[model samples]
Target: MTTVPPEAERLLENEPVMAHFATCADGRPHAAPVWFRYEDDTVEIVTTGRKLENVRENPKVALSIQADDGGDTQWMVTLLGTATIVEDEAETDEARRRINEKYGAPSDAYEENELVRIDVGTASYRTY
Candidate 1:
């Protein structure tokens, strides 16, 4: 697995920005916003519905995150990775808390969502 660059990691961990998670299944692509936590070389997200279904069907995914101020872009990062669906209830709960904490939400928020960890294979970033 490729590691996220230091500058990109700092941006990801410091900003509470929404990531655009992308998945493709059966020749169709889907993208949606999600709250995420970045640690080491992995990006974690708790999600349900179409996003969850897409990941189960196809583990290949991508994520895009940007830091902006007053609608002006400052920096952006894009990650390409393979995703794993974490079925352990305990791990899911812990991941939920971490993600929620980053976004300043309640610890138990989105309890019904399943955890998906993306093992980043490629990471690229740019600053404006």
Candidate 2:
């Protein structure tokens, strides 16, 4: 597993931060905000619909998270990686728990959701 940088690690673990999950299909880009869990040097998100379909066709993906307090200070992190649909029932269940907890979702919610894991290949951040 690749080691997550300290700054990126903090951002990933923060529960309230929303990540923009991006995928490409047929040269078109698609992105959406998501509640995510970062662990074992991987980013996991439970989602379905077009995002899932895009990753199925193209494993390459990106995740961007930013913070803005409406002040001069701002920071952002972007992670580039390859995403795989998680098929193992056990892993999917765990992912569901983590994602739901992060977003304060009811325990029963997201149980039937699909899981996607992104193995981060590169990460970059900017602060100002």
Candidate 3:
């Protein structure tokens, strides 16, 4: 697994930016915005539909997040990883808690849903 830089890690943990997630479909790119949590050097997401189907067929994926100050400052982080469809209920529950807490959602209202774990293999960032 590739190590995320300290600054990038801090940003990921604290920033609420939406991640642009991408998966391969028939050797082409399919991308969408997603709410995600960064933990244990992995990116976690709850999703269904085409994104889930794409991952099941091809585990490789990419995600990117960016932040801007509305002035002259901006930063972006990109990650490459292998995505796994989590089937274990226990892990899914834990993912629910973490994701909800990160977004200030009702933790007790956690619902069982499709979970995806992206084990990050590479990370890159740029700030301007």
Candidate 4:
């Protein structure tokens, strides 16, 4: 069993912001901002909007969690993973709870929308 490095674990456990998710389409990348929570070896995010379309068309996804600054020096973690849809209510609810805990509870606006999730398959990190 591989253990998460101390630096990696610390960065994730105390991350200040959510990263953008990019999915490949026709050799190009579609990017969007998303909030995420880490569980075990995976990073999960909520998006019942745009992500639903991107992930459906291409399951291959790359997600990044990093400091929200335009400067060249920033801490970033990039993940290469297969984004599988979580259609199960329980699973979705669990994801909701985790997300709410991290970013605050979901708005009533989310209730009106359909939300699907993406699970990070493999993660890599870089701090500059």
Best by TM-score: 1
Task: Summarize candidate 1's per-residue lDDT along 1-128 as a digit string, tens digits.
Answer: 44788989987887899999999967798999999999888999999999888888999999999988999999999999999999999999999999999899999999999999999999899999
- 3 or 4, which is superior by TM-score? 3
Give me the displacement of residue 14 in model 4, in angstroms: 3.2
Of candidate 4, the 10-residue stretch with the lowest lDDT total is 107-116
Clashes of each: 0, 0, 0, 1
lDDT at 74, model 4:
75
Colliding pairs, model 2: none
| Candidate 4 whole-model C-alpha lDDT, 0 to 1 | 0.68
Candidate 1 worst ten-residue window by lDDT: 1-10
My TM-score estimates for the predictions, one after another, are: 0.96, 0.89, 0.89, 0.77
lDDT of 2 by residue, 1-128 (tens): 55567876877787467899999977988999988899767999988889988998999999998888875548888999999999998888888887788888875586767899999999887888
Error of 3 at 21 (Å): 0.9
Off by over 4 Å in 1: none
Candidate scoring better on lDDT of 1 and 3: 1
lDDT (10s digit) by residue, model 4, range 24-45: 6666898888777765556677
For candidate 3, what is the TM-score?
0.89
lDDT string, candidate 3, 11-75, tens digits: 99888888999999888999999878997679998877889989999999999999878755488
- Rank candidates, TM-score, best first: 1, 2, 3, 4
- Residue 95, model 4: lDDT of 71
